[model samples]
Target: MPHSERPSKRLAVVTGANAGLGFETARGLVYQNYRVVIAARSEHKGRAAVEALLKDCPEADVRFEALDLSRLASVRDFAAALRERETALDVLVNNAGIMALPQRELTEEGFERQLGVNYLGHFLLTSELLPLLTAAGAPRVVQLSSLAHRGGRIDFDDLQGEKGYDPWRAYRQSKLAMLLFSQALQQHSDAESWGLDSLAAHPGLARTALFEHGVRSRALVGALFRLTLPIMTQSAAEGARPILHAATASDFRPGDYFGPGGFAETRGAPERARMSATACDAALAERLWQVSCELTGAMWREETTT
Candidate 1:
């Protein structure tokens, strides 16, 4: 089905909308006439992003809300605030994430920074907002994943990176966990009849600021990224296309993965991409779900039980 024909009575919340792909995704949704709330950690950045959107799309109903995905308490606060203001939510873009930070850090909640922010925070936020999403008809949750997931593995023993931490490895594992969470969410939602569509998307190798956050050698990384970026990277706007398609496209299905259709799935138009074998492991997904509930204390509503 064409995007124009998709249902429009939807409210969308996109995390990390201050810049890069998140900003682009919000812009696309606003262009489609959706009431969008851009969630960011910094109030200044959030307000600036919303103002920028308004500059381009004067009719855009975009607003900024504070949300620090690394902290579970902040996630709860944001969710509670949203619940108080909105009766229903049609779309959630779990698009905010950190990548390749050189330092090994933990969130305020004490989980590995990458895992907490990239996966668990979204996990809790989504569960908390499930009721609002259920109130809307055919709501969708789009999780931003990464091609680096191909090299990821869930280290049950070192989920917090206690054993060791490599920035890239940690990021990859967190993204892998995100894919697993999206698949598990689809399964549970279907069995329990929640009527929510959970899909995952990757931006491929888009040249975004994700790598500049904590690199020890920013100049070298930036130079290398620029050198290879032409071959591997896509514009942030183009990188956001799959996410918009997954959230707004009619044919999107639960558990479906989307990404670039180009070389190494790096830089091209959006397409339904293949998930790694680990991402499709139901048993692992279920275990991860259970662990997530324990770690984040994110309880599912009765409606989410299979």
Candidate 2:
């Protein structure tokens, strides 16, 4: 429990905060004197997470907000509701995402589930909350990409994974999109004098429930994940460090990407991580930004101060 729930304690929003690295991220922020909102897809899980967090940080100011990123409508609803209650948003951790699903699925909005939830959803959320972020004076937005983004390419032609779906490719592309999005938004912020800092991070190989989805049908993989998880992957607490660092670091840089400093970025302390060249294509990022605005009807151009 915090000794003081100071009025004007910094506020943060952590998506997927109900579990895994997101849970650890939220916990660490609470320790750092943040009043956090745990955004989850399930109200039940969201409330439960707040209850559990209260056990450790009894004075931590935290609450649950239902956020189903898979659907644009849900994103809109969440944003509108958020605006009603809060005028300032200090930190936004876009931490919610799914890894490899054996079969491809689409959101009700009919976009590939991975790209929809991982990249597009956060895109809209960030844009919608841009005003509140600006009101906070200097806000940080952290987009959680992946080491997988190193090998990812955005197939703009098959954005929805309609031609043929490989779960890893879809997941990778979404992560790549995240990096590109972060970089592009930062560029816009600098050009427009938005005073918003946008950054990216990866957890490397953190042992989390996210793996359960990938290993469900493959007995061999499941066994490997179970047996080697502890040995190969870092704990969720370790994974959250990069995120918490990006959110609160004093020397933070816009468009900076952070991850593990160890071998292949698998596990260790935080550092400036690698990213794919494809993630740097300005033309591609502009196209993706436009596509995201069209898909979500977020209309971020209207938010420009200039």
Candidate 3:
């Protein structure tokens, strides 16, 4: 279907809608007439964000819902709530994610913090919500990734960073896993005629709380980030455009990746960006899919296989 022809009355669920690219993506979707559900980890922040969005766009159909992607039970509960409330979901933006934290942490579910929240959590969430997404004529799943994925390696033996952990390395691996998952999802959907579009996008380098979160936890690193922000950062709104385009643009194809189109994809307008070679590896994509299924215990394989 053409982009213009896509239904405007659709419902969109955006994770991490309390701030950064997720907030901006919600705003853009609201402007485009989508009834947006802002899924956040904190009720206070989510409510505050909804109020702020309404202040700018009084008619914006935006609501807040609590979701902490680091917890599998929370993901299941969130998915169940959405299923009970809505008959169909036209767009699901797996936008909530964490970046480099100085120390390795584990989620409530016992997975590496970054991997748990950024990749595995979304993996399970999407799988559980597949019924809602599939109910719509053409649903879209947009997985938010990062350029750092270029240097990532899927350490199967050390997926949880239990053997050893470097914050940035773990973050990169998680983001790469997200990209590969999106790609695998697209391929699976196509092979099974699942009637959904799976796409990936990244916010090059945007000045968001992610950087602040990194710095606040470590002074020297925080200082370095503040020092470099002016030279490397782009506005959150600009960074979110690729995600919006991938979610709503008519030209999108399954497994397509989008991002800023300037200065090594660091800062510019949104465009169809190229993914890293590692992210495009079919073998790794399949391996990640199997591992994700084992972790989430989601019925994705059964649904697609049948």
CA RMSD of each candidate after superposition: 4.5, 3.8, 4.1
141-191: candidate 2 lDDT, tens digit per residue: 999998889889989789999999998898899999999999999988888
Ranking by lDDT: 3, 2, 1
Q: State the C-alpha lDDT per candidate.
A: 0.87, 0.88, 0.89
Clashes of 3: 0
Model 3 TM-score, 2 decimals: 0.92
Give the TM-score (vs. native) of candidate 1.
0.93
For this target, which candidate reaches the highest lDDT against the unseen true structure? Answer: 3
Number of colliding residue pairs in model 1: 0
RMSD of 2: 3.8
Structure candidate 3, residue pairs in collision: none
Off by over 4 Å in 1: 1-9, 212-224, 302-306
True-vs-predicted CA distance for residue 290, candidate 1, Å: 0.3
Residue 273 of model 2: what lDDT?
91
User: Residue by residue across 1-306, what tens digits does model 3's lDDT show?
Assistant: 113333458899999999999999999999999999999999999999999999999998899988999889999899888776777789999999888877889999789999999999999999988877887878999999998899999999999999998988999999999999999999988898778999999988887888567556767877876788777778889889999999999987788999999888988888888788999999999999999899878786322321
